[model samples]
Target chain A: MAGVAEFTKFPSESLKVGKGFKLAEVDPDTTPGYPGNKADGEALLEELDDKLAELQEKLFAESKFGGTKRVLLILQGMDTAGKGGIVKHVLGAMDPQGVQFKSFKAPTPEERAYDFLWRIEREVPGAGMLGVFDRSHYEDVLIHRVHRWADPKEIERRYKAINEFEARQVAVGTKVIKVMLHISNDEQKERLLARLDNPAKHWKYNTEDLKQRAFWDDYMAAYQAAFDATNTDHAPWYVVPASKKWYARIAVQQLLLEGLGEFDLEWPKAEFDVEAERRLVERS
Target chain B: MAGVAEFTKFPSESLKVGKGFKLAEVDPDTTPGYPGNKADGEALLEELDDKLAELQEKLFAESKFGGTKRVLLILQGMDTAGKGGIVKHVLGAMDPQGVQFKSFKAPTPEERAYDFLWRIEREVPGAGMLGVFDRSHYEDVLIHRVHRWADPKEIERRYKAINEFEARQVAVGTKVIKVMLHISNDEQKERLLARLDNPAKHWKYNTEDLKQRAFWDDYMAAYQAAFDATNTDHAPWYVVPASKKWYARIAVQQLLLEGLGEFDLEWPKAEFDVEAERRLVERS
Candidate 1:
């Protein structure tokens, strides 16, 4: 029954981005917050499942009965930085019904016609849901900035717009947990090569991923620029080390557990007369 | 390592609705296909998780590579028949990313404005997704029939419309597995009473659910009529005995496995040349 904080060597606060936070200094290979090896980390994750599921159900129940609070887990990472893996392992632990999962690929023609946040705003989780964005609005800032798809002024505007958008979300009771999964260039290369080496994994081996690899430094700098602009107290970013897949998964899981714990979620009080309902059921 | 078929005393085929299927005759307390006790069913569910996950990923992968095949699991039953439990335990075993879960409640103003199928068609899973409807278009027939919300002619028309809609879905590689989680009225009363007894479960208790109980026989007859009309080779109904919670979970899990198995799903062949991608990764 050890709490997530007890299992982690580094508290979640230590992983939080603060003033003068630099993404470059993070060691993607290091298991930040958690001191456990793979086996230990996996065990801790399994242990946290029940607590996490209960907390999530409480949030979902609260939403059903007029609670507006919802958590948005925004994952921003380079290719092979394990964004999808975090989703599969962390958010996967909760009821799929409770999790509003959306993976943003390149914008479609209809999406491109609208403002960037238009598509995003439409997908925000309603009260009592866990909203997950697998490569979300941050893409506008990251890829849009890297490819110079937008003018420098427009790109700068997007950062401000994103901050305000998130602030509005917070004002309306959203707990935004933005995570940047940091992985080394060498690790990315190894993963890409590994995918190529296996036929079964070939479907995941995107040629564009290699093309994007050439711009590794640009993406990092773009991410850093993004973190500097949009990391607010209302919606802070957590820089998770992703060189070790196990560490990345566990850290995100703990971050989510910590996020849900903040709600101090209690199951909503019975709205009906319990005794009367019991009588009604018995008579039926 | 046993296949799902071996664990079940009754195969999924027997559970599937055929000509002259009688909802009244179905013993909700009996574990039709599954012979094992609760503990064994739980164990088997745990064992099937890995294979189920693998098959689902393959289906998802296929969708990414231009495969249009998808599976839609339609869950319909009276209140407290454990629809939510099936979702939590069965579909939950797979990656949430691959499962498109939707719970259809009473239609909204906008939904009521459109044809019932309009709201439904919008939520149908895209290629390679496992779409789940907690309660579906069948509500139009069941509730509508019980209350005469729609005239007899209109209700009859809806049955034809639903069959045609499902036929369209199947024509385009959608495998529709409609399941009615059959729980006896007695079992439902016990569940409702149990919910009322627990403070934590208060949010789940709806006064309307008890009111629905009075119309139980009408609902059952309506379901039988609907089944007799709509059960087709392409999209059929499965009546699962849901009084035993563990039995329902494992049976749905097996149905899903069998549905996915029909695809003979294989990993998509690498679209890119292997040597070329390997060299690119090596150079990067």
Candidate 2:
């Protein structure tokens, strides 16, 4: 939040957090984007943020009042991996009116009664808009698998359900982009301790993170398993090394830009003739 | 992740994310910690991270193999508030063997069969361990209120339930720390758009964020209301301005340290005489 930073293209393949992708192989210190100083990178990020905002505005305008297709960004990461920074600096650029951000917390009593995707379905960005899931149905597989919350059979079933669900989204024109923000255990400790040392951040620290930290290996394996099971071309999972906050932030921004660009989104044509509208304005 | 940073004490009063709090009031860019460049801040963060790691180790050691009391830190915030950051940095420093982190995603079919807190109770940090809830039952009142998922009476009822739940935790020797990572609307935009620009980050961008962004005012009001309704002396809510990633990270770490400090946690006394045990081990 201090300032946006510029980012360069990210090596998505190197950072994928799933099968064939070992979390241990990624270095949190590596900056995949602009290899500039923090200040310059941040400044560039601000500039890029503005540019992205314009694109999102157009994307949203097209989707909503403009009659364009919609976009959905699914951010997945362990606790404190900077998914939030991406949201604040990248997605934040879009006009709030046109975007939909859902931070999926624990499901409620009613949500539990239905399939996991049911709630996700209710919140998918409609036509001509972009939708963001801070955490998504993927949790049903990731955390569930790590913790063995469900039997292997059930977990297997949900993975299939997820693939089918996403295929459905793509069919309906929801550009489903999934990114796993990958951070190292060392980096994770640094981030968590910052909060422990600062009183103002007390509310942000969860003792459970320490508890879950216990399962880092399990979670990593789980993520790898989930990615292997669900990383379809229609919804391929890109793993981003997240140890470097700036790199992760800008890399994600760039990723989003590319996704939207593929849509060939345009400012919706004016509702009326430009010449006539201009003449009326001139008269007024 | 690159380099850790040094941090100063944070202002808890100013950062409380609840009632009488204006999101705009706090500048996200403020680094109450070390006011140096990003590099220095990160360095100090790393130094603090190691120390906190040691402390958490002691805390956990006293509980698990050591036998100590329990700690719970609950984090609640709007999307992109950096809860994840605190989790990685501060809590990550702790021994993963003893930490239990539960990110409460949307409820599952089985979870919905009971009250909101049903699942929460099942996940509380056990004796001598640390438990973290990425998002707790607070969502029952938060998102529910913003979208009118529940009536006013129901919202009020849930608030009461949360207070009671925390009170019970206190009775059971659980140190419940609640935090809210607050960011300005402008900061949020920068983040969201960054996601849009980066194809790699498209997954992090949720169109739903924009829809939720549309209801910023409503969510803000709802947050303030919830804070008033549920924030208690025993489990008070601290709002940290997260625009400054370092400041927020350090603040939460400090808060957790203080919480753990109060416990007088010590390496649990050995069950048997150390010298005798050592002699037996030597014999073996």
Candidate 3:
């Protein structure tokens, strides 16, 4: 992914968690790409919400005008990584119909028996719709590697598989935006404890978060390896800080908006005679 | 079919095209139910557009809060009857993801071997969606009856089948809104000629529309008969005047708005800690 040209619309230096990336050196609390404070971010998001919504509609309406384009946004992070918050806040700004969201959980016996990518292939959005994966096959490399569920050799093979899979999707007109929400262990500990303190949040509290915290170093190493192996020019991975919740939310939304901004979609021309239809209306 | 109580929100006498109705006696240019002029009707529609859109979001979001609901909008009309116009102007105002539209054409050879209702059963929208049928199986009773493609005995049987089919849909939580756009013969001529004159509209000016125009009287008789036989309490029909283009467009929007208005939908409750999450944001 080195020697890549800069994106026409993605000019922000703060959010470019891309190639030559190393996980340990990056600060979890730094808003590297954001220019505004939380209040300014909130105001920016308020304006973006409508722009993103209208862009989605334009993307959808384009297919009727003989344009075939699709988008797949892959979101990967650890427990309480603000993945759900991104969906509820950043991606939720549009008509729910325009986007399809899936949170991939542990594989069933049937799923595991097949290739790991087999379960994900069919779920990609069809042309003209946006598909969001809250947790993706990156889990296979991240969790699977950290827990030693797969040997290093096998984990490396899956990384290559993911790279090839996304390249093929790009070849078929699907734009892939992969994001990893980076948060410090300290922030995660507070989030986990908050879930335990509140009865209403009991449903979100998973004891596995505590167990996984013990292997934090191994998980970080796994994420670094996965990023090096799979981050490609075709579908690059972006890491955004999650400690500042509102900043992370708006940054991710900006990433998606800038990505779609390159497409140059426009209002589809009416297929009928405008003057004639107007005359008909006027006569009536 | 006859004993059901009146619709709670459907109190307009102008929009009713029900059983025991005769086509010739009804004025094609009158707006009996509307309490406004053309400009006022246009303003009302502008208001209803946003109301209908929000209602659709509530309907789609309801199942997350433990409610299951679906809507099927069935539109039947003659050539240049403004069926497509209503879909483009009215249904187009909302998020397209929540609405599914199908313009049913002639049945394929594969579809012809099965019963008429078989093709339709599979197309009904699932829970939490709005399905719009630009043309529905009511064609079986209308054109099929008018052209004598089916014997009167079979036609009679199909009517009974339609009632059972719609009742099943209603029983399973799909609200069916049936509308017939009624336009005068003079208006039809003007529309057909307008299509002929405009090169841009040539694609829409079907030669079949000319063939069907010869059988206009028979088609009217077919429509009258179809209304009497199949206008059930579960899925009644509305005949909105289409001579005035804006009037018909707004009227159909009102009908669908009123149909979904009765649904008791609310914002789906968050399964997580609303209070704690708010606190977490505030702290951040």
**Top candidate, metric TM-score:** 1
Which pairs in model 3 have colliding backbones?
A: A14-A32, A14-A33
lDDT of 1 by residue, B205-264 (tens): 999998888999999999998998899998989999899999888889889888989899
lDDT of 3 by residue, A1-284 (tens): 23322223342345555667688887889776455677767777767787887677677767555677778989888788899778767775765545766669899999999999999997897676778888988999999998889998899899989999999999887889888899998888788777666654554555456668778888889888988988888887788888888878877887878777877867565566656654544443
lDDT of 1 at B123: 94
Compose the digit string of candidate 2's lDDT tens values, residues B164-245. Answer: 9999988877888887777877777666655454544443445456668778889888877887787788788877767877
lDDT of 3 by residue, B207-271 (tens): 56666877889999998888888777778888877888777877788777778887876666556
Candidate maximizing DockQ: 1
* Selected candidate, larger TM-score, 1 vs 2: 1
Higher-ranked by DockQ: 1 or 2: 1
TM-score of chain A of 3: 0.92
Docking class of 2: incorrect
**What C-alpha lDDT, on a 0 to 100 scale, does residue B101 get in candidate 2?**
72
Docking class of 1: high
- TM-score of chain B, candidate 3? 0.91
lDDT of every model, 2 decimals: 0.89, 0.72, 0.77
Task: Give the least accurate 10-residue stretch of model 1 chain A, judged by summed lDDT.
Answer: A2-11
Colliding pairs, model 1: B10-B33
Task: List candidate 2 segments past 4 Å from native.
Answer: A1-19, A64-68, A281-284, B1-284
- In TM-score terms, candidate 1 sits at 0.98
